[model samples]
Target: MKRRHFAEGAVVAALAQAVAVPAHAQTRPGGAGWVTSWAASVHGPYPVGNPSAQPEQRFLFPSPPDGARDQTLRLVLRPSVWGRRARLRFSNAFGTAPLVLDGVHAGLQLGSATLVAGTNRPVSFAGTGSVTIPPGGQAWSDPVELPFAAEPASPLLAGRKLAVSFHVAGTSGPMTWHAKALQTSYGTAPGAGARGAEEGEDAFPFSTASWFFLDALDMEAPAGTPVVLCLGDSITDGTASTMNGDDRWPDVLARRLNAAVPNRVAVVNAGIGGNQVVGPAEYGPGKPFPGGPSALARLERDVISLSGVTTVVWLEGTNDFSRNGNASLEAVRDGMVEGVKRIRAGVPGVRVVGATVTSALGSSSAAHGHQGQDENRKALNTFIRDGGLFDAVVDFDRATLDPGSGGLRPEMIPESTTGGPGDKLHPNRAGYLAMGSSIDPAAVLPVRR
Candidate 1:
């Protein structure tokens, strides 16, 4: 495989430029703050990474390089916590040319591609309706007040999805996207022109299971609200769980926190399917991997740069031991050590919890189910529990491991999304619930005063 290596310093510098938020935009009146209510970490440019349950996109975007031309996209995402004011982040992290976007709007979703009546609000950047983000860069929109989210702590808004619509002006070159969103989002046909302000679903004739351009959404929240970020690979990304079910372990964790702490906490997932902890030494548009960037490479952009992050749950490393990766066990362990150190340095007083990788011993996937791979996974899990590197540990392995067969529990092996036997690599909805319920909320959340 051909590999292109860019200087790590250069990549970090570029990401730093992309995440630079203006000083005035940091806080709201009376010391209210911004917390990342939702986030989808961007990997490679379009059509280069793994996307689950995706529909054919040749009709929506004929040329991947030319990207979306004069089309509107309505992305559906659920916020862990609701707020009266919110901001959106658009990224061009993997594009080869400037990404020009306009006609942006955010509203409460009534259903597929449609927003609640009188709730669609226009979003602006620096007081303007449109913004141009340079290649390898991103921009955050000015705070847009959400009239529908009057009470941030209201149970009525819990589990409701947010509809963020935006138009891609001209050609987007190579679009930055998160493949494997697992949630269906709507889009207009190419050259259909800007229809983001439309409240109806007629303008969006196509659907995709991925998110493009737009990445992070921040809600104005209380100053001390704790934000728990789950950083890992597909399991954390909800693969094989359910279609539009929001049953990922992080989603379960969020619900747990909401019931225990009310609106005092937020949980965001930053997982990418096929991702590894450190094996892919380099990643960019020229040398893209199906897994996206390595955990170490993306830690800065995905974990450190997000707003109001108080704790991190790191669940990864199974991919690094897979047949495709074949990365040594030491490399994976050290990479995680380095990653945790970076996270602590970037966010002061942040607690980092390590979750053991689950069993893939008898997986149906060709790349997994090897004895050697399972051995490596066990070694890593042992380290996670006894290494004393993390503030806490979540025993996901014990939660789903079947001692009899050395594989996932029998009840957790069947697929829940489209039905059929599962790959045994990624857990099903029941397995995810087992993993989620195993977590002790107090271990990952901030102690009450």
Candidate 2:
């Protein structure tokens, strides 16, 4: 839906042209066209606590420490649905310090679905496996630059995973994974692992947003193929998804699309934990406990211009409702409006699918969640669901809340999913799954030929 017109001709024309638009601008005004978000894929941060990262939790874990010495994680995944070649993304978007790793290998599955898949091929970063990720920054593997591909493999990753066994010279910290990292890893002190490390470890972290920056794991469609990006806060990051499980709804959804659909879509998870949509206040841009920087500050850089990004699945603002933001409903809503406007300006006609702020009411967390927070969420949801502002809406608020309790469902949210109710603010893997499932395929683009 278009915004209500208030400006006149030239000004409106300039505004229209200014958004970070795809190169295929019609070269004429008021003509006919919709910028298709081609080669767009969806994904999210998988959360996990690494025993090596947290020694206290080490014994509770079953695997050996990875990356502690310079480990390698190998993922063996074969795309069931193929298309033009695609680029791969590795993230360190949230690290507080520098990141380093060696040897990233990507290849077709060999004898088995295991990393031991015999006779597999090697994938390179830009061209080499070794790379560095600056604090709070991200990088992408050089495009595989292969030919258009397809699959008879009915299943997207039918028994496929990654084999990332590298040598760690240095790091910001221990690797914590959410959604159980999709690859097998080992750590050998820098310069270690001359050949490769063991594929299996005792356990792996299923971290949501902190996918340890990333190793060579993505299969990018050619520049013009279809892909979508999901960008936002903890919710979008798969915070509560299973460790090394890759079950975040978006992950789930990606597998679904790649497996059964003809669009050959991919999903990229750009969710940052504790991200906010209104100010630079979150990521400590200015003060302590500052939440992640506001969405506005980084939207143009992270979302609008991402490679192969066509459609953006945007969800955020729950942090705004918290006391930390101290933002009024009116002010926050206006902030969202502005964020959306800025986005349209950058990627002209790029579809923005907005997910309403879910309920934080009745959170068991003694910290906050008063009636006020709940009310604000409801108000924000109303504005978002009201079509004209966003091209589409995904009302997850209507999904996780218990119809009876009006909070997270007590049943669907057992101790495991709800984190045993300690601080009801964040859910466990199960809860994250519930939230992820709330995404409706209809809200995103339908299967387009």
Candidate 3:
């Protein structure tokens, strides 16, 4: 075997001594194991969805069809929880051809595209440096130890972001991507070739506010570390919140959980901008929609298939009531009911919490602000609070609604992302903080023994 393969095999063997199971195995009964620390639900192929604050990509990816050719992309993301061993998952769920990736590395971000010294580590797949994922497929990397994260609960590591670098070996036809990353990531010009091994920013000349191919990051944590997934639309996806500030409602909730439990729990966001509980009845690469897929359609891949999820906080349905969707109130309600049943069946003993839909009574967007939309939203909120379908309920509607105006609170109207009088639909940073703080941590997490 090649020396590189031998080294990877040794790493796997060392991990087996601690895990006793394959790297893909998520939970291990009563022992510390893998838990999803960060995740982004991919919607569709490139340039087909809503992207916030996106820069022109003509230079880096001149042709969307050809997609990343011999280029390196360094994606930066924050993990809610830290651990010594980490693994990554890359998706081709929306690709039309095989996605060939190689020269992968993971390290601590040191601003822009540079990585912290002595922290970058090679990532492999089944003891190989590369992997080819067929269309509509995904692959997970072998476990690699994070030397900087030896103390998983270290305060110094809290809020730190991880930089994952990878090279697209050939033309990646129609790359599967999460459009609204809202966090800056660096990429090299097309044909740059194998720059993933570099630790400097010079090789990476361009930047993007989106994430491509890579989707989920898993970390070994104490057994039974509850992972609370916030699944919703733009609000849950941090639409109007500050960019790169990590002040989304889900981010705020993670901070709250960290303070109370101190790395004992993880919160991951699986929200897609413009996503709905129902509508767009069918979706795929051929019939791509900006919202990607419906909540019921993506539940398995976004929620059930993730690692060590113990609770799911479902907050959606606003988009379904939008003029673009015009779905009936009953249809959305039934979708949620069915979606909950599927979650229960897929992950036994998982708690599903329903968050009431916030008001879009006078949204600035052309697709929303209709009286009919607000009516349906109010009706859905009632059902979510009293429907008895969810294990628990979080009243996000009440948290942001202004009783007098029947719209978003006055203070929540100013946008925090790009700075403007905010859209009446999504809340600003202050509003997100209110929504995040409203959740009782005890409701989402089990009491410490």
Q: What residue runs in model 2 are displaced by over 4 Å at the alpha carbon?
A: 1-86, 90-101, 107-114, 125-139, 145-159, 170-186, 189-210, 215-218, 222-224, 255-263, 279-291, 415-440, 446-449
lDDT of 3 by residue, 1-449 (tens): 00111132332332223312323336656677889999999978898888888888998899999999999999999998999999999999999999999999999999999999899999999999999999999999999999999999989999999999999998999989999888999999999999888888999989999999999999999776778899988889988888899999999888866765567668999999999898688999988999989999999899999998878999999999998899999999999999999998898777789999888887889999899999999899899999899988988887888889999888888999889887899889988888987876545653332
Off by over 4 Å in 1: 1-29
lDDT of 1 by residue, 377-413 (tens): 9999999999999999989988888888999988888
The collision pairs in model 3 are: 413-422
Query: Using Cα atoms with residue i matched to residue i, what is each candidate's TM-score against the true structure?
Result: 0.93, 0.68, 0.93
After aligning candidate 1 to the native by TM-score, how far in Å is the CA of 345 from where it should be?
A: 0.6
Worst 10 residues of 2 by lDDT: 38-47
Better of 1 and 2 by lDDT: 1
Say which prediction, candidate 1 or candidate 2, comes out ahead on TM-score: 1
Off by over 4 Å in 3: 1-25, 28-30, 446-449
Instruction: Name the lDDT value of residue 336 in candidate 2.
Output: 82
